[model samples]
Target: MELRDIDLNLLVVFNELLHQGRVSAAARTLGMSQPAVSNALSRLRKLLGDDVFLNTSKGMVPTPLSERLAEPIAFALGTIHDTLNSKAEFDPATSARNFTVAMTDIGEISFLPALMKRLSEVAPGVTLSTVRNTAVNLREEMENARTDLAIGFLPDLQTGFFQRRLFSQRYVCLFRKGHPLAEQGITLKSFCAAEHVAIVAAGTGHGMVDESIQRAGITRKVRLQVPHFVAVGHILQTTDLIAVVPEAYAKRTLEPFDLETAVCPVKIPQIVINMLWHGRHHREPGNQWLRQTVFEEFSS
Candidate 1:
């Protein structure tokens, strides 16, 4: 392929199409008409001398050639985007930039309110949109810029991602204020006998608490399994189910309801919370400012 034959704009369209996987969706993302995007794809195919993409029942599937080109094209685009952005100063107070954050529900409860209040005072024009973080796809999402940052207990991020430890939290058991377990402090025997509610954030019934219990050679009865920490309050308040959650989350829920928290009977390891971003955004001024803001606010 001749350098003169390549239109850089066509590569941008190709990258968007690769990410979106559908012509209409790519058009919306690129702010181009469907025909324009299709035309660009045609031009790219002709220039590259391969049918770069194929329309399938599932979506637009990239051919082997397209798959090979994806990384280099994306890297080049990212470099260009970051270079162009680096030239401009990022004044958060005046800039109307939207950032997408990926976090778990627990993270939302722990950080969103304080972060928003600080943002309102310091960066009135800035906006934040949050998406749930699933460790499975976090690396892909960040690399593609689908999420600017992910805040949670993500210990499995790949080598290419940059992560800053935000905080460390230990498990605390929460129960109704008047529950029998609350009267006398939690003990291994009582904790083992009580019916518990387990938070299965990773869709696995067993978590750190379970591991700790097993290590102590104690078998605790899990009467219920919940997907989120936010539901712990209502479940504990109305039912006799006790839940072991992060200390920060336990404290947050206790004030609103007649709930009490105590140290977990079984010793679970502290969870390390981190703010993760792709290396692609590591040097971008806007991302740097945001990362610094988060580090200053939450790193404890």
Candidate 2:
């Protein structure tokens, strides 16, 4: 609006006049009448108390004051124009963008290590952060750009979202290598008889596992229930309890906890993990790259 309490428009006229170097020429370039240009120059002279230009035999010559201010004014105007016109896309190697992805703890265990390793190799300056996918405001957060992407089985994020299927996860039973089931092998009867720890991932995509178990009419000896997969491996390793988990997640924990996985005896729903983002981010360069990274890393 104003520059140092002077009208910004006057500086525009001044810059054009400095370039054109004649009142009539500057007037035609600015789409203004010669009289209007003279009025603006008169006002600028009064404001700056300088004869900014001199009518010479050759042309309108810039005064010493005009020469002194020329470079900075040109630089400022050129910088603003370049910034407004720029369409530069994200460059991962040079970008310092911090992106947020929402996922379950299982998604974290199954996805983060490889993802981080790849990021370190290609996009070392880019950073990542995570939030629980089950958080109440997840959809709102994604729409608002606070959450950049989501990974896991998120059926509720259907409307106003774009998703790519990464893989379908089959259920498996995990137990410590020393557990009796490791020797006995899992059978329908043995599976139903064992003390089990169920992941109470209520009302989300993974909850379909429990819902399928219920609908199948196979009554398991339920010993404990937990809300997340973070401690399932350690809990089962220290106890006789066996927990049903995604096959990938079970395998990931197996060696670390000295656990063994047996084929789930009953038919339960297969969870389809997907990469999801708000429709708003469908064309954003950074979001596209991040989605591609997830698809490339975990997609089956």
Candidate 3:
């Protein structure tokens, strides 16, 4: 495994394989022949003394060693590309940059409308895509450079990531307008008696609201459990089920729909929503612009 004897070009082929998942596909992406890419992969495997990738029924899968190396290699490539094609400054008025952000449905529903309005006027050429938040693995995604920014409540972010508190919010119960509960303010006893739609995620049956209710020696029955808060709004529109949602999202998402908010029968602690990013781009101009734009948008 002499460093001097190893072909540096093999790493590029290896990275392309990891990105494209097949030798033929990787060759097409790298603008090289399939046999040449396969030869490079074989030489790389021998030089490293490990099978970096293995072919399976589905396709080529990266070995654990290769999986561990993927982030560093991808970051190195990105940095090299950025350095070679560096822009002196990012001009929002003229530049056409597409940004990919990861956020939950609630974040999209709450922020996208206003954010888009601002972006249309200021950065008309810019575009955005929202990645679904299936799990709370935001730190890993951000550190790997797979996402530009993650907008959510990541309570267990790693140390290398930075966070800026966008705003603080709390949970409030939402129900259809002119419901039975509208006559009187919701009480703990009456809240438990009503059917509820639980916003469950990450295999947890209860949310922060349920925890607060438990602390008060009350157990609210959760009749329906769904993954996204946007679904909660839809259900509330047609059903008698009540849902506890983030106060900010509840206000924005329920505006068009016929819904009313009632003070949570049980006191729930407020949620501090923050924007998270890896320190790798902590000083980069484009990332700085995005962070500032999002902060200003949310603040206003």
- Predicted structure with the largest lDDT when compared to the true one: 2
Residue lDDT tens for model 1, 181-300: 888888888998899998888732226777787888988799998777777898999887898888888888887888999988788888888888999999888999999999999999
Q: Any residue pairs clashing in model 1, and if so which?
A: none
State TM-scores per candidate: 0.70, 0.76, 0.68
lDDT of 2 at 22: 90
What residue pairs are clashing in model 3?
none
Question: Model 3, range 229-271, lDDT digits (tens) per residue?
Answer: 7678778888888888888877885677889998886888887
lDDT of each: 0.87, 0.89, 0.82
Which lDDT value does model 3 have at 224? 92
lDDT of 2 by residue, 1-300 (tens): 246678777888899999998999999998999999999999999999999999999888889999998999889888988998987699999999999999888888998999999999999999999999776589999999999999888878889999999999899889998888899899988888899998888656767677777888877788898898888988998999998888989889989999999988888778888889999999999999999988988888
* Backbone clash numbers for all candidates listed: 0, 0, 0
Which residue runs does candidate 1 get wrong by more than 4 Å?
Answer: 1-86, 203-206
Candidate with the larger lDDT of 2 and 3: 2
